[model samples]
Target: MECVFCHIVRGEAAAHLVYEDRAVVAFLDARPLFEGHVLVVPREHLPTLTDLPPQLLGPYYAVVRRLAGAVQTAMGAEGSFVAANNRVSQSVPHFHTHVVPRRRKDGLRGFFWPRGRYPDAARAAEVARRVREVVSADGAG
Candidate 1:
């Protein structure tokens, strides 16, 4: 299937990219549920977590953890949620992790999500690179 997330991973679709490396690519969701909601995706485009190697899982979730910290610091988010929707709510048909920056009253109620607007590209890129660096350095350490 021609997945939109794959295109974003391939750079065919313009995304407000926050992070990228040989193993992963992360960017802001175009229609986000929160201001700094980001997606951490594998470059290889596995369709589900079950398809990922057990070893790869640590690095993958590591990326998510680093970004969550960045999201909290950068966006002043009070809290956050990270998830991967496989059978029930996978919108892109590719294995990707969502790192959503949450505040106390962001109105993200019980997984009944709402679409939030995308930020400016320059700001997004800056945030993305910062997040990428944080995750990359942590991965290296």
Candidate 2:
């Protein structure tokens, strides 16, 4: 219950949710390296990538693939940076994949750690909802 991403998935906490399905939820990162940086997370609170169930792997990656394209296309970025953390640098206890929008020499150098906050919760939720709409129609997660 203390896991923040879990609360977000349940709508118990505010998040910029862009995509959802049976297995996964994708949302805007509260503090991001770029405006459209998104977090694709599993619905079940798996603590790390190695903790993921084998049955859920396909569905999860499908959602991530969809969101990667959405982040680039929707945010008008030339490319995308898709990555995840295990125990190290894992901000939340739950597992998550980062789908960040990228441009050439956009000052996102190094470990891609620069972060920024949303101007307001409404804006964050709005962006997340919009992303959700795009990824939802692609197929079932």
Off by over 4 Å in 1: 110-141
The candidate that wins on TM-score is 2
Model 2 misplaced stretches (Cα beyond 4 Å): 110-141
| Predicted candidate 1 versus true structure: per-residue lDDT over 26-90, tens digit per residue | 99988888789899998887889878877888888889999999988889988788888885788
Roughly what TM-score does model 1 have, to 2 decimal places?
0.74
Residue 110 shift from truth in candidate 1, angstroms? 4.4
Kindly provide the TM-score of model 2 when superposed on the true structure, using C-alpha atoms: 0.77
Residue-level lDDT tens digits of model 2 in 1-141 = 499999999999998789999889999999998989999999999999989988999999999999999899999999999999999889898999999999999986756577789999999999999888878876543
The root-mean-square deviation over C-alpha atoms between each candidate and the true structure, in angstroms, is 15.4, 16.2
lDDT for every model?
Answer: 0.85, 0.91
Clashes of each: 1, 5
